[model samples]
Target: MSTNNQNDVVSHAINAAQANAEDSQAQQQVEELSSMLQSSTADANVDTSSEE
Candidate 1:
């Protein structure tokens, strides 16, 4: 392959890796938020139930 082609391939691969890393981090944040929301909802439910 030509040097230009190789460089393009390398650049594309780097960009893909960076994107994957960012996506994974974002997914982790989403999971954490979901967990926090579930916990908060459960606590709120308990509070409401106790008031009855």
Candidate 2:
């Protein structure tokens, strides 16, 4: 392969790895937010029930 082609391939590989890492990080953030929401909702429910 030509030097230009090799460079392009390496660039693409690096970009793909970075994209995958970003996606994984985003997924982790979503999971953390969901867990926090669920925990808060459960707490609110308990408080409401106790007041009844």
Candidate 3:
């Protein structure tokens, strides 16, 4: 293969890896946010019940 072809292949691979990393980070953030929301909802429910 030519040098240019090799460079193109490497560039594509790097882009794909970077995209995957970003996707994983986004998923982690979503999970963390979901957990926070669930915890807050539970705490709010408890507080409401205790107020009765």
> Compared with the true structure, what per-residue lDDT tens digits does model 2 show for residues 1-52?
6445654665565555556656778667655655665566567657766887
Candidate 3 ranges beyond 4 A from true positions: 1-22
Off by over 4 Å in 2: 1-22
The residue-level lDDT of candidate 1 at 3 comes to 41
Give per-residue CA lDDT, model 1, range 1-52, as digits (tens).
6445654665565555556656778667655655665566567657866887
Model 1: weakest 10-residue lDDT segment is 2-11
**Whole-model Cα lDDT of every candidate shown, in order:** 0.61, 0.60, 0.60
For all predicted structures, in order, the TM-scores are 0.55, 0.55, 0.52
Total clashing residue pairs per candidate? 0, 0, 0
- Compose the digit string of candidate 3's lDDT tens values, residues 1-52: 6445654665565555556656778667655655665566567657766877
Please state the error at residue 41 of candidate 2 in Å.
0.5
In Å, residue 40's CA in model 3 sits off its true spot by 0.9
